[model samples]
Target: MTGFIVPGSPEWLRLITPSKVPAILGVSRFKSQFTLWHEMAGSVAPAPVSERQQDDYDYGHAAEAAAAEYWKWKHAGWRLSRGEVQLRNPSLPFAHLATIDRRASRGRSRRVVEVKTARDLYEYGDDGSGEVPADYAAQVLTQQLISGWHDDADLVVWPQYGMPRIYKVPFNEAVAAAIVARCAAWVESLRAGTPPNLDDSITCYETVRALHPDIDDVEIEIDEGLAVDYLELDARRKEIEAAARGAKTKVLDAMGRARVAVVGDVKVADRRAGKHSIALYPATKNLSQIQEHAA
Candidate 1:
C-alpha cells in the first residue's frame, strides 16, 4: 500500500511494490494443476483419475496457436504489447499480461479489443447455439472493469477464428466497482486460508468429479454423522481451486482483449508429427557443441 500510488487520479495506479508484484503476476501455470484437480473433486459424481490422463495434459498446439494469433493481430496493424501486469485489492494483489491494440480510425486513434481465446470458447444450448459463453462473459466483464480503470477506456471482442464475429460491451464505474469487490472477496478468502465454498452447485461438483475420479467419496456438504473428514478437506481444496480458476479466467480474458507482441521469434528445434519443441528465446549463438570435438 505504501508505494502503490498513481500520478493523478485513483484510477491510474495501484502502488504495487516489488515484493507483492511477483505474487500478483507471477506465472501461475503450475498452480493450475492443483486447481484443476480440486475442481474435478467438487463434481457431483466426483470421478477421480485412476491414473493421470495425458490427452488433456499436453497443450503445445494451443500455445503455438496463441502465439500465432498474437502475431497475426500484430501484422494486421494492431498495437500489441506483452509482459505480466499487476492487479490488486485489499485482500490480494496479482498481475497478468496486459495486451493493447490501438489504431487510427476516422483520423483519430481507436481501441476496441477483448481478452480471450479459442480454448476459452465453449458451446452450449439446446442445439449447441449460445450467444456468448457465460464463463467468458464473467471474465470479459472483469477485464473491462480493469481496463476502464487504468487505461480510461474499454475493450471489444474479436473472435480469432470461425465466423467473423465482434462485440462491444459498455463499461461503467459501477461495473468496475462490482468486479473489484468480487476480486477483493476472493483475495480475502486467500488471505484467511479459507477459499469461499460456493454451494456445491450441481454443475461445479459434477464437473470436478468428472475430471478427478481418485476420490471415491464426494459430497456437497459435510454431514457430521456421515463421512465428515474427507468432506472438509475436499471442500476446502475445491474452493481454493475454484478461486484459481476464476483468476485464470480473468487474466486470459484480459489478454484476449489486447493483441500480443512477443519479444522474440520461436524456432522449432525438434518435432515428431504430433509433438514439437520450440526454443523459448531466439537462438543467438550457434551450437557447435553438438559436433564431436577433434578426437
Candidate 2:
C-alpha cells in the first residue's frame, strides 16, 4: 500500500505533500504561501536548483543513512526501516502525499523518524524536548496524519559540529486537522484559479518579479500613501547605513595597527585582507577632490 511515483515529478506536483504544509500555513521560512500557490497553479515554474544547492541536497540524502544508523545504535531495541516508500489517504477529498525518511517500530508502537541535517541547532530545541522549527513540526505532523501513525515521532537532527540529537514530536489531532482543512481549501483555490494574497517575504517578492519579468513602457500610478511610505523607509535606511559606516570608521581607527580587536575573552572584529581593498572614508565630493588632486 505504498506509492511508486517519484517526488518533484509532474504527477507529484499535482498533489500536496508534507513539505508544502508549512508554506500553506505561512510558517515556512524559505517560501511564502503566495509563491507556493503560483507554483502549484502552474503559473510560474519553480526556481532552478544551483550547483551548491544540489550538492547540499546530495549531502543531506547521504547524511540520512548515517543518521539512521546512529538512531539504531542509540536505540538498540527499536527496529528501523527506510525506503522510497510513499503514503496517501484516499478517503480525503484532496490529494495529499507523504514520503517519510524512516519508520521506527517497537512491539505495537510505531514512530515516524525524520532525519534532518542542519548547520546548527538554532531552530531546534534541547534534546528529547520534542521542540523543533514550526515548519519541521508541520512536516512531521502531516506525515503522521497520512501514515496513520499518531505515536510520538522521532526528529533526529544532526548538526554539522555536534552529535545528533533526537527530539520526540507527539502528534496533535487538532493541528493535523487544521493542516488538512487548510490544504484542502488551498487545493480548491488552485482548482478555482484563486491565488493566495502576496506577503512581505522575500520569496513572495521574488516570485512576483519572476512572474512579470517583461515590463511595459506604459506608466501606471500606484497608491500615493504606498509611495510615501516607501520613500520614508528608503530615507531611514540610508540614515542607518550612514550611521553604521561612521561606527565602523571609529572601530577601525581604534584598531589601527592591530588586525583584530578583543575585549576580555570576547573577540570583537577582525580586519582581514581581501581581494578588494576597503575604503575607510566615504567617497564624498571633498574626498574625491583630494584623491584626484595633490594633498
Candidate 3:
C-alpha cells in the first residue's frame, strides 16, 4: 500500500498562517512576541503603534529640540549629542539623543535618553501635552541593547500643538537582548530565502484573508509553474526582506494589514470588470511573473 499527503489541505492552512510562517522560516521572533507584549501593555488603541510611521514622523528640527529639552529634564544634565553610535556588535542608529543630557545628582552615574517627537500623543495620554509614541520605545530599547546600556533609555515627546511630555521607561536587558537576537535571526532567515514565522494570538491570518473579498475563492497551485516562477519570487522576497530594517512587530503587522487592503482593491477591480476576482498573494512571485500569469 502507498500513502500520499493531500495538497492544499486544512493542515496546510494551519501550517502556513501568518503566525506560523515566521516560525517555519525562523524569522523575526521579536516581532511575534513584541506584538503580544504591546497588546497586553495596551494604552488605548486596539493595535500598537508602528515604527515605520513613527520614523517618518520623527524627521526635523523642532522635534529634535523638544526631545532634547525633555531628555534634559529627564536625565538632569546628561550630555546630549546627535548621529549614530557604534560599540562592539551592530551599530545603533539614534538620530536625536546621541549623548547623555543629564548628570547624576548624588552618584557618578549617567544615563542615556532618547527623544522622539510627533504630532500626536493621544495614544500615550492626554496630559495637556504630547507623549512619546510606543513605536519609539522599541527603537530606544534596540539602541540600549547595542550600547550595553539596557533599561537606561527615556523617551521625550513634543506634540505639534501642545506641551511636551517626558517619560522614562526602563529597558529590560533580557527583553532587549532577546529582541536583538530575534531580529538578527530574522535577517538570517531572510537571507536564507524563507518566510519568517511569527505567531500572535491577536494577529490572525484570517483577518488578512477576510479583508480580501477574493480570498474565499483563491486558487491553489502545485506544479512546474512554481519552479518556473521561483527565481522571480526569490527577488521579490529579497525586496520585502530588505524593507525590514529597524522594523518592529507593530510595523510588520501593519504591512500584513496593508496586504489585505491590496487584495481588496484587486477584488474590487475584478468586480468592476465582471471577471473572476483574485486575492493578492504574499510577495511569493515576481512582478513580471504576476503580470504574465495574471494577464
CA RMSD of each candidate after superposition? 19.2, 9.5, 20.4
Instruction: State the lDDT at 285 in candidate 3.
Output: 22
lDDT of each: 0.36, 0.81, 0.43
Task: Kindly list the per-residue Cα lDDT of model 3 for residues 1-295, writing each as its tens digit.
Answer: 0232222233322221222223322343233433322222231122333886556544634466656756566555566555323333334221112222222222545345555444445423332223333445555555455555654555666666457666765778676556555655544544454542434434434333333435455666678886768778889889877774434343444555343322322311111111374233233223344465567
lDDT of 2 by residue, 31-140 (tens): 99999999888888888889988987898899899999999998889988865457888767798788889988999888899988875454343322346878889999
Q: In model 2, what lDDT does residue 285 have?
A: 22
In what order do the candidates fall by lDDT, top score first?
Answer: 2, 3, 1
Question: Which ranges of candidate 3 are over 4 A from the true structure?
Answer: 1-59, 73-75, 82-110, 123-134, 197-295
Clashing pairs in 2: none
Location of the lowest summed lDDT over 10 successive residues in candidate 3: 265-274
The backbone clash count of each candidate, in order, is 32, 0, 17
Model 2 segments more than 4 A misplaced: 123-130, 241-295
